[model samples]
Target chain A: MGISMENGLSTNKSVGKQSVLFQNPPCVLGYSSIAGKKEGEGPLGSCFDIIEEDPLAGGKSWEDAESRLQKKAAELAIQKASLQPKDIRYLIAGDLLGQLIATSFGIVDLEIPMFGVYGACSTMGESISIAAMLIDGGFADKVIALTSSHFAGAEKQFRFPLDYGNQRPLAATWTVTGSGAVILGSPKEVKKLPEDTNPTIHITGITTGKVMDYGIKDSMNMGACMAPAAADVIFHNLSDFDRKPDYYDKIITGDLGYVGADILKDIMKEKGYDISKNHMDCGVEIFSKETQDTHSGGSGCGCSAITLTGYVFKKMIQREWKKVLFVPTGALLSTVSFNEGNSVPGIAHGVVIEIME
Target chain B: MGISMENGLSTNKSVGKQSVLFQNPPCVLGYSSIAGKKEGEGPLGSCFDIIEEDPLAGGKSWEDAESRLQKKAAELAIQKASLQPKDIRYLIAGDLLGQLIATSFGIVDLEIPMFGVYGACSTMGESISIAAMLIDGGFADKVIALTSSHFAGAEKQFRFPLDYGNQRPLAATWTVTGSGAVILGSPKEVKKLPEDTNPTIHITGITTGKVMDYGIKDSMNMGACMAPAAADVIFHNLSDFDRKPDYYDKIITGDLGYVGADILKDIMKEKGYDISKNHMDCGVEIFSKETQDTHSGGSGCGCSAITLTGYVFKKMIQREWKKVLFVPTGALLSTVSFNEGNSVPGIAHGVVIEIME
Candidate 1:
């Protein structure tokens, strides 16, 4: 469908059912990823911009620590882009905390017009989609998309307290303690790369996901809960664009660990898409099963966020991976809802990022 | 600042600072407001579309009840719009719950691509702003903007359990149990009102807000916690458009009750705008101060939402109010944050609604 503006500009941005194809793709001017000590020791540890050895991040509490991490990442991203806080038109951010307290406290000091979003771990994708659309839609010149998660905070909020010494199932994934932020800009604000040899990254399109519930109720097995959602959106993204899985260099899922990764491939196979060869999961890549002993893998909003900003972007800038489909999956369940015996539904958002030559 | 599109259309949607002035405003296709028993007994009782006497809304738990309330409102709004769920391109909705369980569970059945947003109780305004922008930007033809808050559910999540029979502070505002949903559509989908005499309602502009903190720690006195934020946005909305208090038929606030209302007026007065005569609050209007015994007034995401869709929209249709600046204020505090001795910050979002000739 095409919409003709009163000014006589007819633009068709809506793609297929759930995707948006930007007419003027928004450029990723700057990006930053701050990781905790544990994530810094992971395989991709060296890619993080800042690695904080202190879990508290010099803050009073776990939530405060998470907030500090987010603030640091946001500031670094803006500084990298050579823009002040006032130059950012909007701050689209969120976390795993209730009421988005982490974001409310973290970005309050920055004082940018804010929009708090929550989609469990998929927040990074959601924020990027909204920010890109806002820029492409002629609403703003520059916008910040950010998200974070803390191990202690997520455990206290979602599962048992750390002091309780609770036992986790093999399917459980560890929440990554980190924050990632990116500054997206309009064409006018886009500057040439610091290194002329580097390729510019642009958010070309996005596919928003529907809540998919297969009636999975386990909070511990978040990957199992979120895997269906990941498969559904990946299928839709491919179908919406009428392309095969080989169209992109890589298709990455946010945190579908070892078990859920297998489930995701099975689901995709049933849907007639063979993504096995090029599929990758951030959860599986962040930690080594033999060395780290993490049952499933690393997971959280920060999982995919830092992976994309720190690792994937590096590959794209170096011309290793030219086009990528980044899909972040989220399990929608609160302690209250989980205890109430409600099913853990899942949602995933897909962002199409490609190197602009 | 104006953006010149590749299609040769130069549109200046950004107003002063944090506001956006839509070149092609989106129309409100339909709206629904569902209230609980307590709200049904209030002054705006007859205005609500449906009043569920059972706090559970026939669900087993408080969270489930709130989810059911949201589902009912969303369905009703779509039905009123003469559209199926399939017609909605996106659903921007959230509730005052951890992980937004209410929204996650409520709208899952709708099968629409979703974007969950949270701004405490100011979520209604945020959702509407996003939905309108998507429509105006040609990213979506129709979008559903929704939010809900339930007294019992909120009490459990943010305060004490209902069984505790906690003492009510005189300064405390009662959380309203209600849900409100509105379907915004592009001009191409604009249909004439059922009544030929009724004018069409359009979202003309929006003022997104920044998180404001004054170190207010009293959750019971949320009016004080949110008043400054409300004042900041109202001041910016007026300044951004270069308008005075008289420019709007009424300057309406979301849930700033008696205490916050006074504070808001005082702040605005100091800011060089005397809005004493035209200032109205949804919380103050929802209930009778003398008889209802709701200490300050009814306050929640639902407070401003229902008031707008029910009472405020009726008045606009009757020509009693031709233009309104609707601001929904939110005190950003979770039980965890409050327990941790963190300060309660606030945020508010403003939407400009006017009758189109």
Candidate 2:
């Protein structure tokens, strides 16, 4: 018999988006990502590369690496904003350490008030969303958002002890082992929020993912593993605001690997909402090569954070895209669940990005 | 044999008062604290007290209690502020989990943008200081400062494993075992920065604590543990402003126990600064022999948080006090340190809280 979720939590869609309307006084300050040593220079494609040597093994512990990531990200954001340590009022950041403990302690020495946040891979959009809200809400003069992940750290906490043996199941999705940060503040001129921003992407709506498990027969395909939750959020986001696929320039989801992406597309079409113009998942984008051979895309909190920082933000700044919906998904399960014979349950949250030129 | 701290560490003082500073547009609307159990409480002292029983005795897990504390604190503060969940810009709260995982996951469902903060026991004050700064700096419209601590949670993380049979020391201070939350917003008619508020009690000074091995030390006597740090800030505040004890009405430290409070008075007197008329502490005030002998006073994140919420804040509203300095002290030792037989060192950050009337 397959193991079932004992809690029987309803697996549903979860996505929240609040629009800042038209104000874009803030600009992207700085961005950075740290790939654990084992994370090779390039993204890993499939399960076969899972056996690569531990990248963080030779250097600092994953905690140390993450610590460095926090400092670097903050420094870059602060420097880009042309602010001193004391100048920024708050640093809002988080990761998937079950509660972002490392990022919290690591930033203490920076001598700034910190707001730790977590949304699994959705953290990038989550941070930006909150930063935007803070800006529009008039709570802060400036705010910084950051997130990071080290393979060793992730492995120790989620899957196997750094020193333990592991196997790559077809369903075992890859977690983007990286960190990213952004800074936001007001424009002195009382200018409108960025309009060219991601598709007038005001988060006018949200539908959070729920604990869901549709009986994964195998642990190898996370696309299939997290498809339902993704579909749920995508479907809900559209319905909640009386929106359709055409509302956003692009609709994005955090790493869901190859299978989940296909499933999402299928689900969208099935629901009569076609987002064909632009529908992407970071999981699929990060491991586009067969050589990387990641059965799924990079997973973990860093998955979305790094992608948004490295790809989405840059793309947005260059006016390459506007009005994008960012939804980072997570399969909230511990190694014990897999070992205990539980099909992984999934959840995802979305935030819209808009830049008013 | 005795505690030794660096020179002039605590001599930090407040920034000068500037009357009629511009008020940020958003202002704090609501706040609440949970000292005991609520409907679905976690550990005692924190807002969520459902898990107050001993975790070692099979009561509840720290993760369970800690997460509940964060959620409850945020919820209460949100309710008090009369803001919708989406109306909040961020949830900035954190505690001493392996990765501050408790608070991170706790707010996952709240759906507001988040900024996780960690300053150990000082988290309470650190959160407020930054929230205030963020508001004053004009960064966001709304910011919530929340923190929580459970006795069982603290014991396992800071002192001993639930099952460990180590001899607890008297000097060791008990964690405040509670949760408190406050909201900072861009006031519609923003008040001047911290010392500028009418009848303002500016945070005259602040001194972060360093780990000093006062040979006679353990975790219990945290007030005693942090007395020196308090002395430094007291002196620094005096020196920074070159003011005497009569500069303001009151000076209060966050959660230094009775022992620490006494030591601070002595240390300040020796320095030719006498703040004898009005000085208080969270540790010594939150609880009494009748409430629970807590040895000397309330200690932990909740100590300062609750003290400010239940005592200091109400007192301000009552107009019985003005021009007060609120210093929230923290002991930075970790569970590893206790295991290594290391004496706990401390730090205290200060913020000036006063009535605008």
Candidate 3:
């Protein structure tokens, strides 16, 4: 990767399209994942840094609980990086809520300058992408990317209240109650961990997704609404980088679940790239369908976030996967839009993470 | 503004605390503001690019109307910049809506890579801050910072439904029905207009704000809720840059109405800075308290946004005000948060706009 520099600034970070190849890749200094009771009982339960047994997270409301989850994850991530909140220059965060109430309340105590982003469930990817760009672009030395979602709160906001006892269709996915926080720093700022024998993870590049609307009006089947966007970003990420599917050890999608995952593979195949072999989805990997009864799998901002911070990062640190393209898909819809007969649009952001050489 | 370079990369963009003084300042190429009939009748009505008399903007719902407002402003801004939607690298946008449905649906037609941001009414500042950073950091050549707010939609979302005929408190401000879009580009990318000659406006520096909660639970009195935040950022910007308030020709706040403006001035005075001589509030400027019947003043993301794009930019181009510190303040609250007895927190971002020398 040749960096065309004039004076003291790199002029060519933008790739073919919808992607940025960082000249100075930002490293993931530390990360923490906090999960709820149901998530703690899932297959990747043990991977989480902290698991709250109480559904309300010792709070009065579900939104407050999610806020607590986010606060805990942020603090733990900072502690893991051996840094304080004051040391972080910026905090990029958002959640799937009206006006991002959860995020506004959650990270307020951290007192870091924040850029609130909304990409539905894809918020984690968006946050990380912005954080990496800020670091690589020399705007900040260290930044924290954070996001969270709550099952009960999401249901109340997007669907019926718990007292209504509404039945979900098979295509409806459960919103994961969890939060994930990652502390990213410039390569020079991150301290090399001597105790860890594996490799450090660096965000080498990113592919930002546009709003893709296939006119899918059914909010229950978010996988269908988001599959097209997931596919679009994934296709472009490969095309823009001129890389083959085999180039990466794993191509991970946030919460495509069983249905959207198949659709994504088919879409990629049509685009002449076969990602089926290496394709993995956090939704499908998070829980057991038979035991958990999570029909379409866990879906939310936390779905991919916790999976990445808890499960995937552990695997990467153990040298299981060398390179990964992590794509988080989001179904952009609100009760107001849906009630107004608006179609559910979807957006996805892709982050390229690789082990340092 | 000496930039210390390490291998052709500026490493000293970060200023004293929360501010970033850009070495290569990004220039504002073009801007557009779309206002509804009510805003069109306001004091700055003539400055708007377009005014839609129809409340719906030919759309069925208020949300759709707001989305249309965003779309029109974006397209017009691109056209004003003498570029197409394809020419822009990224779209930084958000609205005062749940899940940012307006933004998601509004700019989807533009098909640019988008980053949805939320800072309540302070979103214009947040979006522009990120957009300027992207250009200054060399991640993008051109970007559009966009935001919108609808009176009816906000009334329903935040306070009371319009149909309820709810009585408003004297301290309450009216939500502005408008949208503002600004096209910012690398100084090298923006084309100079020979037809008209004036100093080009450049985003020289930015001071990002942290969430400040004074435990003010009154949603109706948002002016009181956001004043502290507005004061905090202004103080930091002046302190970080080591300048007095008089360094700026005018210190402009987004929508801190008459109430908040007084509080902000008092706060600044308490901090050993008297800005009353050169302070201005968009809320107070946009409407007439006596004739408009607006209790406190105008408020919303669009209040400050349209004021900046339509009125302030025009004044700057006319050489009326040379340098200005534009601070947009946001009161972070949700209906749930308010109902749950949680206090409304405030955040504000400051952008220093100066005439290029």
Candidate 4:
């Protein structure tokens, strides 16, 4: 017979198997956000830790620019946590680039144990969930979860180059050039911190998402492609926890722009739950249409990541919000797959964060 | 205050804070492997579950052929375990292609909750480690860890297309066109199996690897690029567990091939432990020098995956070996990064598997 563990917390916090309710949630020790010029001009500009005016960020290429964003964000997060690079046991990171080049090149200097994950635009949520699991399961004491996306880099790889200047559809979303990093510490580790520190935000639970293919093949319209997946995860998270829309102070989605947000509301309405009143999307909140001229809004692995690190995280710390359900959605498709006539599939992961002050 | 319980096992199986020694390891219920024509003619040819003589495998493109390999392997693995698609709670998969298209397009029909991962050739070890952790942590009852790689597809993406006919260096390893899948189940789930089934292999522990860069810039020689990392992980595993090389019947490196195997031995020797006698590389064992033109032997995500599923696993089942250390090494460098003059970083994860009978 195998050994069984009740440990510090029972391992039976799973709700309906898709979600894990962490009995001893991991504390968010610190977080950092780095955004590009366009993102700096957006409404959440003042909240970012670093606003890089040069798209290249003094790097030789756009890919290298993204690497700089990741590096700065990670370094700043660790610094803010009053910890050195050696104190981190693991680094869970990813990016929108092929093979996660930005993350590999960015954090190579840290030399921490790395777990590279891919969830398209939803990588931030996936990274955070895995890092929390490692800490909650007692495998790690301190871990950092980070992701990044560069507009020029993603455009060159996934779509026409900047020189092409191809006109995008009205439903298309702009890839955010930014990076976000959050440091999660175990309770024992957090207890060693200074008593004058701010109250910590806890990741109480996570809902893993499945790839949902609604047979949408539009590569340009990522919001539409990811709406179904966002709806599915939102619906499942509520049903699994037996919660309603009002259970959370704010229900946040990664990128579903205005169009996709409406679509998600309709999808939820058909499922007997209406989330319209308390719904907010990072993509829609990031940019003001009148000034930004972004057709649909911002969408990328960095979109929700920076928003969380910059906006929601600060709100929770200031007691403006008690609880929030953060869902990051991803459109899982490659240019090759789209060129091959395959439809796009989408995925979304949900993380429940709460402040107990 | 956190909830505390001391029920069965302690959630503190960590060794030296770098590895996890599972108190209740997950069982390997079943595994399957599918290989291409070239691999079929290799030394371990007869051990594979299926061998597709045609490289195309009746598909329109090489990518589709790789997808077929994944589908066939997954189906056969589940069949061998007497389980259905619905029984699997998650599918952890990856490949050598950009964006993991081979895996996404390959296993989309299964509709399992997928955690797309990328560690290049070391993806197999990463996938298995995550799946085992999930099972041991009580997050899922059953999960399938799978990965694939195709020579043509990889060459076209990372190097030159098949039509280019580029001459490769002597140190260049051949990418193995194959796929492997392993079904991991919790103890309670495995206990429900029929009594007449063969003995199950248990994943007792895992040592997660960190990205190690030795400033190796030559992308063509992946074995040399990955050797330092292989040595780093092997050293850490030994130091963490306080065990010698003789602890297991064999210590297998994923795709170190002939050159890297020697380098790994020398590195281990300098660390005051000699692993020369017990070390075996999947890349070297998979192909015969005289028969196959693979200069340094086979290399790819499939190399170690198929070797583990087809060869080493059979030996463990028959009690030929009571225990083995499976280490898959990855060279993390994209063509874009390489072209930009970035050095290749390597990573290696060690998984200890033992027969529980």
Q: Write the per-residue lDDT of candidate 4 for residues A6-26, one digit (tens) a residue.
A: 211124755654677886888
Residues B1-357 of candidate 1: C-alpha lDDT, one tens digit per residue: 242232111337888887888888888888999999989999999989999999899999888899999999999988888778988999999989889999999999999999999998999999999999998998988899999999988998888988899899988999999999988888777665556223288899999999999999999999999999999999988887889899999999999899999999999999999999999999999989989999999888999999998899989988899899999999998988899999999999999999987
User: Model 1 Cα displacement at A186 (Å)?
Assistant: 0.7
Preferred candidate (DockQ higher): 3 or 4:
3
User: What total of clashing residue pairs does each candidate reach?
Assistant: 0, 127, 0, 2
DockQ of 4: 0.40
The candidate 3 chain A region of ten consecutive residues with least summed lDDT is: A1-10
Native-to-model Cα distance after best TM-score fit, residue B129 in candidate 3, in Å: 0.5
Give the lDDT of residue A338 in candidate 1. 89
Could you tell me every candidate's TM-score relative to the true structure?
Answer: 0.96, 0.68, 0.97, 0.95
Off by over 4 Å in 1: A1-11, A196-199, B1-11, B196-199
DockQ of 1: 0.54
Please provide, for model 3 over B273-338, each residue's C-alpha lDDT reduced to its tens digit, 9 standing for 90 to 100: 999999999999988887898888999999999999999988888879989999999999799889
The lDDT of model 4 is 0.86
- The candidate 1 chain B region of ten consecutive residues with least summed lDDT is B1-10
Angstrom error of the Cα, residue B344, model 3: value is 0.8
Candidate 3 residue-wise lDDT, A1-357, digit = tens: 332322212358887668889998999888899998899999999999898899998899999999999999999988887778988899999999888889989999999989999999999999999999999878888899999999999999999998998888988889999999998888888565533322289999999999999999998889989999999888878877888888899999998888888888988889898998999999998888999998999999999999999999888888899899999999998999999999999999999999986
Interface RMSD of each: 5.1, 11.4, 4.9, 5.8
Instruction: Tell me the TM-score of model 2.
Output: 0.68
